[model samples]
Target: MRREFAILAILGSLLLAGCSQLERLTLIRPSAQHRGYTQIAPRYDFSGKHGRDTGDAAMLLAAGSMFFQRGQLDEAEEQARKALKAQPGSGDANTLLGLIADARGDAAGAGLLFRSVADAAPANGVYANNYGAWLCANGRAAESLDWFDRAMADPAYPTPVRALANAGDCARKAGQPVRAEASWRAALALDATHPQALAGMAAMAFAQGEYLEARAFVERWLAVAPDEPAALQLAMQVEEKRGDNVAASRYRSRLQAISPGPTTAPRTQ
Candidate 1:
């Protein structure tokens, strides 16, 4: 289990080419409860001799996104590469490939690819999301905000909740917990059970010495994601803070049994 919580689960957003193909990702392949995604018509204005190729690439990229969500990396890569081969300027294909590069431990290559797509499609919500995420990952969280705003500016952009959650997460990471909570609250108003927003609320409460509030948030999060390690950690800490030695000990023991170490919550994929 990857214990690290991330605001942006990368590869940006995918444009929908067909209804059935896109619905699979929204319903069957959600990464988490807060993982609602949007699939819309291609942002690329395919035209001229390459119009068919660009359209084909869009379709292929959508297929690739499903595979990517399913953790079928090779198949996803094949689809993405085919899309790129069909239309070299396809931002969709580039975002997929860029995420693949990041997963493969080639952050430099991922940065270059994400930057290229972002530069070419400044107004594209998908590229903006991707580039914002890339910037956040590279210690530029402050700068990431502009791109995230750019993404949300597209009225047609689906999943504003995810963008809000990303903003909250980035703000939290940047040591602005109050601002983070405000963003999370906004997300919660839209989606009450959004896991990221709930977890963030729990974290903020915990850091501020509000143990019971943190515990409440933790319980809510666990109801949605029962086996999440970070939630478990939060639970144990809150219990300990509340003077429930037995509950804390039990949670700690459970954490020790399930994870590599009870205390070391290292970020992972």
Candidate 2:
């Protein structure tokens, strides 16, 4: 059993500058697109011979997902539990329930639930990726890398780049910079403008005293995510390293404007 886990910090936290964005676990029901809810990528089609009530369970899962997206956690949990009752071994229902548990700060329960589904369907890259992210967030960074790799092993996985980017984050956290860089490069190869990959590369270059390369990556990152505080923070660092105090201060001013409260100067690398 794991210890009680800490809740993830909001995006605006100062520590965000040090790590890539963690993809939020979302329910991706196939029917969601037709129902006017925004459809997310990595479409996980949950198919299995659960029971005679499979259609009922699917509808319930879709409803639960809509509720979850709307911030109605209680309603979402109720629907997810009902779906589970209809189809006892439904991976979709279990995944939804895990997401609800995650929202409620029950990380241990969430991890168990996620792991159950991932183990049940080894080929389901979406489930593997979600579980990997959960592991990374719960202080199991080293173990998470294998799950991310498993996700990428599936050719049908729609968002291999997402798993790659996440793998880089967990690898870096696990003190494996070489593995992290490889993962980041793989993600960038798939999607050159990926913000997380760009951010990771920029941070790596800055750390290695490659200010010019870091600046270029920062420019690319900011182009895609102009308001991303971390990119702005890194931009400031790059300019300062290159002896361009004026550019650094400009980025500092921009960052301070968007960030809450009085901002402290970011540390020198």
Candidate 3:
């Protein structure tokens, strides 16, 4: 359950290719309510051999991205590798490869690839967010905070709220409740119905034995993410704390319906 609360749930954003004719494209499969991402589309000018190669790589990368979204990992990797071959050091190709590695459970490999891309493109907030999410999900929660900050600092980053919510999750994991709350508050200010922020507030409240506050946050979270297993589990725990057996049972039934296996909530007071 704690793992599900990670900011990595917010996956890859789009990768830009070429310098001309920009349009938005989705590079990763969408998840939950808030994870769809976009980036400038590729329109390479075939003015020279190098330009033609870049255009080919961009086409391969775009095809690879579509394959990835469709869950064809092998095909995706093959296309990404071809893209890399066409455009050596292509950040977009590396991003797709990194995502594929992650989906295949190669966290260390994925981290290295993502880090290389983030380092190569210091001003790219999307890459920064990707690296931060990987770090937090892989147990370096404290170190991940700086990357999220970097993501937010990029004025062109379309979704600062994503970084803020992720920062809140990492802050809490790093045992910085004050920072976590502050980050979550900032995220909620931007998007009032942000599920992760609401979940963080609820967990913090529950841990502090503020059952009423926890319940309020849980209600808000559930209203937005009705089918989320974590939210349902947390709601059950909060209801139990409030001695509302009926409500607890209702939440438990919903959770079990979605996920039969037991899921332990974060430690509470």
Give each model's whole-structure lDDT.
0.63, 0.71, 0.70
Query: Which has the better lDDT: candidate 1, or candidate 3?
Result: 3
Residue 54 of model 2, lDDT score: 54
Instruction: Put down candidate 2 lDDT per residue, 1-269, tens digits, no spaces.
Output: 11110112223322122223223221223222222222342233333223224547656666666666567888778777877787677766787787777677677898899899889878777778778988887788899999999989977666788789888878888889999999999999999998878888888888889999999999998998898877888899789889999999899899989986655544322
Question: Where does candidate 2 have its weakest 10-residue lDDT segment?
Answer: 1-10
TM-score of each: 0.71, 0.80, 0.77
* Residues 73-164, model 3: lDDT tens digits: 89778878877898688666787888788777677898899899889878777778878877877789899899999989977677888789
TM-score-sorted candidate list, best first: 2, 3, 1
lDDT of 1 by residue, 200-237 (tens): 88878887888888888888988887767777777887
Candidates sorted by lDDT, best first: 2, 3, 1
Worst 10 residues of 1 by lDDT: 23-32
Per-model C-alpha RMSD = 9.7, 7.8, 9.5
Residue 77 of model 2 has an lDDT of 80
